[model samples]
Target: MTSKIKNNTEKPTSGIRAIAEELGISIATVDRALHDRGRISEKTRARVLQVAEQLNYHPNRAARDLRLNRRFRVSINFPTGIPPFFDALRSGIEEGALPFSSTLDIEFHSYSLPYDHARNSIQSALDASVDGIIAVPPNTFQMAELVRKANMKGIPIVCISTDVPESGRLTAITAYPFNCGAMAAEALFSHMNKRGSVGVLTGNLEYLNHAEKVRGFRTMLSQLSPAFSVAAVIEAHDDPHEAYQGVRRLLQSTPKMAGLYISTANSISALTALREAGRLDSVAVVTTDLIPELVPYLREGIVKATIYQCPETQGSLAIRTLYWYLSEGMRPLHFIGVIPQLIIRSNLDLYISTNKYIAR
Candidate 1:
């Protein structure tokens, strides 16, 4: 038989085909030998194995093993009691995982606690011997340590929505929060003609995403419009009631506040407060997310604009990145930045169904 080998040093595209050509064997025999199928002579199998190794032949390990194994466990950890934005993220991840179900085994863990308790949850996941992990940004030093431990154990990690600094995780699929903040501020000032005093309602500043947005908003506002001043920044801690009360307090204290920039998921509460006070038509409001509760307000002109970060895309990308790292041993990109979308009532229809945040 004519040998299939040609003068090519690159890795072969097909393992069985490469083996057959390398050994002058039939394709059927080569397939049996490569897969350890019965009826192939030991001598022939040995030859095929040697050829496959020399040619750098590889198979889809996950698929190959799925015939025998039931699952390939992947763990997801996130803070509990988060709003619909996170629910959207979970839905995206679950949808992406569907195609890999034959080989992938998924376990989801949710943590609802103070910052320290959240870190402990991550640590527990690390100890659970999962094949890989996807996590929301962690708040405390313990969480960072758990990430380091996971790396040591050779488990890949995907950070979604927010990120932990200096954690050396596999990949972070998120938007540049600070730049988004700056952009939101720019949108607000443009709508208001850079004439009014603005106040900021925000979540906890410790989270990387939140902190970055605040920084970007402040920096951009200072550089672009010196005339428009930020009267106050109130932290709502991602609580709806707190956000509502904070906005109320801010409006009372900063009576000249002609504009409001809410740089967090608590925009729903802020919108409600603005509506109740009947200040929506008077004061310009710009926020983040397309939460279900906020949609009517956007339609009614109670909220002016929002910055949309597609959390679904973030979740899906994070899991896919982790899978790539695990299967191919590829290093993830240093900084994966998802583009932020500017949403106004005019263009809101296109994004209404997505898990993206609407600022309105």
Candidate 2:
């Protein structure tokens, strides 16, 4: 838990001092050891790093840079659909960047329709002269080209929620969606008790994350339950109506679907379709978010479970990590993986209470 040490007394002053005395080195040497500056022996560096991790030494960036008066402007580009997840992620980014209120300026942008939508957003960010860019690219080669141009112009980029690795951005902070798919199957089928085919629903497969989720679900379902197979895969684009139609079509085509797993947040439509088809009580349904629409489903046990990847954590860390890398000369880990959680009907209320959001 390398979270911020909020209280002043809990600061790492004593820990740093102890490391210096224990190593019989000057305070300056210890400082260099901590910050990875100046020429220090590899052995001493390793020893210092080991001690720091053991001590959970997290530098107070705000306190250190307060006198320096460092101010930065960051821009965010996200998708149009799936408000519950992306909105919470934005909230987390705001909370994480709170400490640097005086020193950071953030701008948010969302993309939709038209081929030049992403390009326009990039131009806006550039015109604003932002220090960094955080984006959820729309899984298109054109979006990649725009992001690459931003990187070429020397603006730091951090991809969040969804990844566009082909853009050659700094790094991406998200959960392993493939693992989410496997976990979804485990959660859905284990609860089923009986082995049978299931339907898989999700957003566009152009996203590497979505495609990987499908891959993981297919792989693990076959390995975990040989009797259970995926009967059909549908792209609902996170629209309730589209999901409803997709599920209806699935029912018409795949009669053996005893369970349904939606790997994306757009799901209310599928629930409606199931209810109308009179199979809502018979088939097991699992979704991928805690949206308001799903709350009633969970309460009635219509939707069995949801797999959340902690959007808040992802959003907060993406901003804070990029901020430190830019302002404090800290090199970050390439992949900051957020762990996923599976929520069931019994605990759905608790999850909703803590993560209450206005439904659109």
Candidate 3:
């Protein structure tokens, strides 16, 4: 008998076709079963899915997108400050866009904090006719105007990490700002045994997120125990030197200061002051954000606890919500607030590993 020659030129069957062949059904039936697109008998649909799974088959997302001609451009406007937090947010944005890689073109614009550096970026994206926008909007007249312009142009904009209420954007996604501060207050209250004067080292109140933390901390603390009071609320302007000097003064002047709440990610400055004053053991410190720099302090109990703002979730939700709205006309809630986590020494390892904050 003549040896049969192998057809090396023949290509392997495509995922859908292989599934169809195995299930003894047509490709159209397999497609309908997989996508729930048309009427198909349940038995056939189940058989198609089981065979597809056994064959380790997956559809080519890029091919599907090209066939459907579904593509969109989205612009991301985020701050460049506080690398630990901001970097995590960036990673979240990337993770959120991975599934849509075949069809989504994302343009990331980084800006400095406490300024409206995103004005030009937003304007440029609008000029380019981007499909959607995700931003950390500052409360600036220029930002408001840009947001309004995008709305007029029919481009949906979603704010992350912070909200500009009057900007008239689509919606805002953030870690619950009020609860972030309230959680810190609760931690400090418990750590200090429910009776102590706590000082707040915060960033600028102009940023609504910062102000909300202070407000929530004060509100919760007062309701928890009138005996526990907020001694001083200093706006450090997110400056290391200013935060250090402010904390030093609080350490010197605030008599028997039992607790301190560093309500911004710029907490290393305040923590340094406490360490220098040799009061790290005396004061119950509650800080915001989980950065690599804070891990050592948390382990040593210099930081009694910290509020993790779930920056990744904020980033992912912002992108996903905007994409869904752009592609499928899906509308999310006016405000999506992720619950913040309180990280203490006992659970430090649970959230911290090298530079990454693992979301639980």
Candidate 4:
């Protein structure tokens, strides 16, 4: 875990100029090191940061905010799904950007694949000359090229929700899917009796988050429930209708299926399939996300459990990380994984209302 820097409650005094003077380096070099731009050696960057810390040289941005000369354009692109999940995320980003209103300009961009039929919303962001990006990229090798292009332009990228770790992003802010999947599997296993085949419903493997979740679920099942083998691993493309059909197919093929593990937020459809199959009570099911659609199922004892990845905090941290890097030259950690919450019928109400997914 990356330790957070304590906010110095003392009023801000001094500026980068003071630190530059003491370091005896050109102000431009100091600026590059602070902003993590240009070709500066590790030694100089460390030296500049150390002296800045000694003098408590925090930039006084109130004046800069007034000028509004240095405007930052940030683009947010999320997957196509229920509004509550993405809406909660966007709300946090808007909240984090509130203090920097004068100097920041945000534009929300929509992107989808297989469903929306558009594979290049990210390219559009680049075409529009966005200074930075926050996105949920599909689990595909093609994203590597886009990320490489962005880095070449010095445009920072932060991946949210699902991450493309190999894309060379500034950082990835996520509710760690591997652990989340394992948690969901453990919940499902505990609720199930002795031995029967359990089905794993996943989104497209092209999305890294969905793939990571399946990996975690499978790993946990192997470790915990050796008797319950995964009868089928189906990809639902994260679409509600598609997930419904996929589950129905699983039930048709595997008549003795005892449990279902859904690794994405398409539960409303999958649950419908289960109910239609008349096996809702017979088969134990665990899903992800605490959206409104899934809530009713949990309350009625139809859906056994869900794993909630706090969308608000993920969104808030993505914006804040970029702002600190762009505004204050704070170099964020490459990967910061936030653990997800295991939501059962009893604790469902709290997670739905409070948005609290802190590490236990």
Clashes of each: 10, 0, 0, 2
Mind giving the per-residue lDDT tens digits that candidate 4 earns over 220-292? Answer: 9889968988998899887778888888899999999989998877778888888888999999999887777
What's each prediction's TM-score? Answer: 0.79, 0.87, 0.79, 0.81
Each model's lDDT comes to: 0.74, 0.80, 0.80, 0.79
lDDT (tens digit, per residue) of candidate 3 on 139-216: 667788889989988998998888877977999988889999999998888888657788999977877788899999
What lDDT score is found at residue 245 in candidate 3?
99
Model 1 TM-score, 2 decimals:
0.79
**Clash number for model 3?**
0
RMSD of 1: 10.3
What are the RMSDs of all candidates, in order?
10.3, 4.1, 8.8, 6.6
Q: 1-360, model 1: which lDDT tens digit per residue?
A: 111112123333366776787788788887776656669888987788788778777444456545566445778877764567777787677666554555666677777645556666667777777788888765457667878888888887778878876887887878789888998888887767647688888877667888788888889988887888888888777778888999888888877778898987678778777778877877888888678777787787777788878778787777667765665465779768889888888988888654344433
Q: How accurate is candidate 2 locally (lDDT)?
A: 0.80
How accurate locally is residue 4 in candidate 1, as Cα lDDT from 0 to 100?
Answer: 16
lDDT of 2 by residue, 272-325 (tens): 888889999888998897888788888888888899989999999999898888
Worst 10 residues of 4 by lDDT: 1-10
* Native-to-model Cα distance after best TM-score fit, residue 269 in candidate 1, in Å: 1.5
Q: lDDT score of model 4?
A: 0.79
- Model 2 collision count: 0
